[model samples]
Target: MLSQPNYREIKSSYLITKEAIELAKLQDIDTKKYKELLKSALEQVLDALGISFDEIRGIKKMDAFF
Candidate 1:
């Protein structure tokens, strides 16, 4: 199991990625490929940590609404 500190770190990273994606969109940058790659990486990390997508707040499922 992941420690609380580690979980927080992962969560922070997830949020940062979300922010980056938003920023990229605002700049009219084509983030399709990058988004897919980041999403995949996030999922993998969450799985490894045994954390569900629902475990994180302030973000939608797989950023579908983004």
Candidate 2:
């Protein structure tokens, strides 16, 4: 995700959080806490943006404009 120049910091940060989960390399040792932290971070970001995960991905895909 960070490889995309079109992805701003917020989007990159979001992807980083996801990558952590995908790679099982979260800083927190506890799996439950890892999920909680990722969930809380995602929820706070989405709540502030007034959108959800699916919506963001849809927007990104549409942005390809091909």
* RMSD after CA superposition, every candidate: 18.5, 20.2
Q: Which candidate number would show the highest TM-score if scored against the true structure? A: 1
**Residue pairs with backbone atoms closer than 3 Å in model 2 (clashes):** none
| TM match of model 2 to true structure | 0.32
Candidate 2 segments exceeding 4 Å error: 1-28, 52-66
lDDT of 2 by residue, 1-66 (tens): 376877766633333433345565546468798677877788778988887655655645565577
Looking at model 1, residue 19 earns an lDDT score of: 50
In candidate 1, list every pair of residues with a backbone clash. none
Instruction: Write down the lDDT that model 1 would get.
Output: 0.64
Q: How far is candidate 2 from the true structure (C-alpha RMSD, Å)?
A: 20.2
lDDT of each: 0.64, 0.65
